[model samples]
Target: MGGRAFSLNTPPIRHDVYLRLVSKFTTLLQTLHEIVRVAPHAPEKITHGDIDVLVASPLRTYTSEEPIALLGAEQCIPGFPTANFAIYEPEIEAYVQLDMRICPPEKIEWEIFYRSYGDLWNILGIMGKRVGISVNQAGVRVSVEHIEKKNKKAAMVHLTDDPRSAVEFFGCDWEKYERGFGTIQEMFDFCAGCRFLDVEISQRREKITVESRRLRDLRPLCQRWFDEYLPKLMGEEAGREIELNVHSREGVLEEALGKFDKRLDHDMLVGMWGKDLFDKEMWRRIRALLPLGTKRGNIVVRALAKRLEEADLGNGEYGALCESEEWRREREANWTEIAKAEWRVILAAVQ
Candidate 1:
C-alpha cells in the first residue's frame, strides 16, 4: 500500500509563524475587496471570514466555470492581499465560488491569471538542489542551488504533464521513483543473465549464477572490459591483448544485452573452458552468416546445441566416459574453477 502526503492545510498548522501569517491573510483579502467593485446579482457575502479555494482538480484554476469534478483541499487564504483580483483558468470556477461566498457582495472589478509555484519542494514533498518550473501558458525554466536538492531535473521529468499528478503518483517524492527504478533495472539485467546459468547440468550453477550477476552489474571500466574488449581477444595462446573497442561485439549476445554491455559477458565463461570452444574469428564468421542487425545469440547457440545433442550414435561402450566417477567429478570441479577465474579477471579489469 502507498501513502499520501500532507498539505499545508492539514489541520494543526504546525508552525507558529505560518499560523499567524494565515490568520492575517483573511483580513488582507477583506481590505482588498472593499476597494474593488462588486458585480450586480452577486450574493452579498461578507469578506471577514475563511473561504475555501480549490487546490487541485481537473478544472482550470483561473478561467473555467465548469463544475468541480475532483475535489482537492479547500483553501483558507482569506483576505489574502491582491493588487487586483485575478483567477487562474483551471481554478477559476472554485475561486469564483469561494470569492462569492467570502468576499464583499460587490463584484471586484479585476483580472484573473495563473502563476506556478517555483518551489518544487513545497509542492512535490521533497527537496532538491535543482528545480524546474513550467506553465501551461508559459514555457519551461530550471534553477540550480547548491543548498537545494540534487534530483531537480528528475523531479521535473516526472512533472512533465502535471506536477500535481506526478507528485501524487510517485507518492509526492521524486526520490522514491528514482530509487525504485534504479533497483528495478539492476535486478532486471542481473536476473536475465543468471537465468541462463540455471540451465547447466553441473554443480557449477551457484558459482555461475554469482558471476553472471556480477557481470550484469558491471560499471565504468568493467562494462567496457566484458562487453567490448573481452570478446575481441583471441585464445590465451594467441596472446591477443584486450583493449576497449566500441565497434566490436558478437551479434547474438549483443542483441539482447548489447545496450547494456557490447556482448554477453557470461558467454566468455563457457568459451574459456573447452579447447574446441568458439574463438573470436569463429564468432565473427557466425555473426556474418546471420541476417544483418540480428542479435539473438543465445537462441542460435541453443538451437544448434539442441540439434547436435540429439544426434544418433553407434552402439558402443561410449558410456564409459560417464562410468568413471572420478572423471565426472573432475569435469565439474575444473569447470567451476575456470568459471570463477574468468569472473575474477573480469571483475578485476572492471574495478
Candidate 2:
C-alpha cells in the first residue's frame, strides 16, 4: 500500500541534453560534496525520465539547500539524503527533474552501483527474496523469521557491507557487471546468469505484488522480459526450467543461512532472543509483575528502559522489578506494606 510518497511530473530528457546536464550538475554538486555522480543510464537508452544524482551525505561544508542552489533548480522537495529538484529547460519550456540521493561516505559506492543500470536491482531483489536475502540501498540482509508482521527493521540481520561480493554470491560475474551491459537484451541475459535465479519464479506474472516495486516491470526493458523473453524461454525449455523442488521460502532461508555463513544469527533468531519476540515476552512478564493498567504500565516500562545499569540483574536490564536483586530485597523487607500498596504510591516512587 505504501507507494512513492512524492512525485514530480517533468518532461523526459533527450540523450544529448541529459549528457549536458549530467556534466553540468556533476561539476556543480562536487563543490558541495566529496563524491557526486549520476547513476548509469540504461544501456542503449536514448531518453531518460530524470537525472539520478547521488551525493555522499554530511555535505562537505554546506547546508542541505546548497546542492539545490548549486544546480540552479527552481524548486526542491527536500528529504534526508534525498531530494527532488526541477530545473527549467528553455527548449521544452518545462521543468526537467533531478533526483538527488545522498548516502553515507562509506556507502556511497554501493548506493551508486545499486541505482545504476535502471531497475536492475528490483529484479535482483525479487530473486534474492526467494532465497531469504534482500538487496536494497542498504546491502545484503538476511530476512529473519516472522518479525516483519511486527517490526520490519528488527526482522533483518545485516549480512555484508559490500554488494559486489553479495552480487557474486547470487551468481553474477563481477567482470560483466563492471564492464556493463551492451544492450537491453544483454542486461536481461546478465540477470539470467544469476545462480540463485529460478527463471520460472523470477518471471512469474503472479509474483508482481508490491505496488511500488511493480513499477519496475512496467519499464520498457522489464516489460519485454516479462511479456516476451520469459514466456518464450519457458515454452522452449519444457520441463527443465521449472525447479524440481520449487524452492519454498523456508528451504531457501535455510540454504541462504548456510551459504552466507549466517548460522549463528539463525540460532539466535530461533532461540527466543529475536528482538520482537523477546520484547513481547518481557512485556507480558512486566504486566504481571506490575499488575498495572496500560497507561501506568507504559510509564513504568519506559522508566525501566531509560534507567542506568546500576544494578546486578542477570540480564543487565531486568524484565520486571522481581528480576532485580535490590527490588527483591526491598520487597522481602516490606512484604506486608508493599503487597497491598496503592498504584499511586508506586507511581510516585517510580517518578
Best by lDDT: 2
Q: On residues 140-213, what C-alpha lDDT tens digit does candidate 1 reach at each position?
A: 22222221143433322112233333333222343432332223233222222211111121223343334334
Q: What lDDT would each prediction earn against the true structure? A: 0.28, 0.67
Q: List residue ranges in candidate 1 displaced over 4 A.
A: 1-49, 52-126, 130-141, 144-165, 168-351
lDDT accuracy of residue 72 in candidate 2: 80
Candidate 2 local Cα displacement, residue 347, angstroms: 12
Per-model TM-score versus the true fold: 0.15, 0.73
lDDT of 2: 0.67
Model 2: colliding residue pairs: none
How many steric overlaps are in each model, in order? Answer: 35, 0
Residue-wise C-alpha lDDT for candidate 2, range 127-209, written one tens digit per residue: 77765678887778877657655666766776776767777877788888888987988888787767666656535657655
